[model samples]
Target: MNAPTAVTRSQTADAVTVILFGAAALVVTAISTVLRILGTFRDQGIAWSIPIDEQPIDATVDSGAASVEGIAQEAMVFAAGVDPVSTAAIIGSLALWALAPLIVIVCVMVVAWNLLRGRFFVRGNARAFDAIGWTLVLAPVLIVLLENVGLNGVTAAMGLETEGPVHPIEFWSIVPLFATGVAVGLIAAAFRQGIRLQRENAVLEHDTRGLV
Candidate 1:
């Protein structure tokens, strides 16, 4: 049997990688949305009581009666209490989510174009894969950042005093972000390798032509 063509191999690999990254992006988006909603729920609350203390006038008489106010406030403070970091995160996440499908579509089109042109093993395919990988990685990070922002804003607006610095959400977001980064880096390295191979193949082809 004849060996598979370079173009055929490249097309197969590209299709698999694109599907993998596309699935990953979708999963990350879903998880991030759930986390953000949970964070929002955790942030939403009303002030139960405000403690006020007073000195006692006499031994027999106790301290003055405490007064409490009943006020409802939104989870986020739009004016004075807004956290700029969290605000930016929310905005960035929304933007990323909106653009993710378009990015995927573009990546698919690039892979299809390369396959049709018989350039799957060339530098272009590698570059396209690298781009898709990086975009996938970025999508999750943006989503996590948005969730963090929403949580931070909610916590601040709640007026809860903390003894020390503490992050509102669990550190799981970092895990996926780190994984995505590693994947992107690997894909970039693979692209570089593919470019080198393509250059070498072109040189060999030129040498063969000269020999003939």
Candidate 2:
């Protein structure tokens, strides 16, 4: 029994260590992206990368042996030479990509660290999970709103002849955003239940001493 329990603990520690290492690497990458956002201003004209799949642009690329995931992942709207992208669009796009995920990851790491130390059923842990869920759901709303405003700036700056305004967010995106939010919310709900039970058990033990 002792041997098995020890083995389980050792494995869990190793897994958590690996997770922390990977999370650190991601945090570093996100910081690098933020730094690149600063570098964008030094350019003669701002270079913005919009997904080819998202934009209705006539473009193609020869992906000979390289395998790319998602539709038109390798293709991007190379409009830097045409006109400069807006400051709001530039910052909004990077923030939407970098800051939103960064916030969620930091919250998860804090909760995970506490759970490993057998300090899981606390109000703080529940709030952290709650934050994770809401951040996943609402961060996009604010960031994307800013990004859309920036995109419109690009449209007007370029003087493009369009039948109507551009649609930044599409129907397909709503599915993943909704699904992810719900999954995180369920985890938060579980944590809240754990905290409630822990508090109730503590009260019962104190009131009815030696009975619990």
Per-prediction backbone clash count: 1, 0
Best by TM-score: 2
Task: Kindly list the per-residue Cα lDDT of model 1 for residues 110-207, writing each as its tens digit.
Answer: 76666655555555566666766777777766666565555555456556542233354544655665576568668768767766776787788889
Q: Write the per-residue lDDT of candidate 2 for residues 2-63, one digit (tens) a residue.
A: 01112358746865985687598677867788677765544455544443334333433475
Candidate 2: the clashing residue pairs are none
Q: In model 2, what is the error at residue 19, expressed in angstroms?
A: 5.3
Query: What overall lDDT goes with each candidate model?
Result: 0.57, 0.62
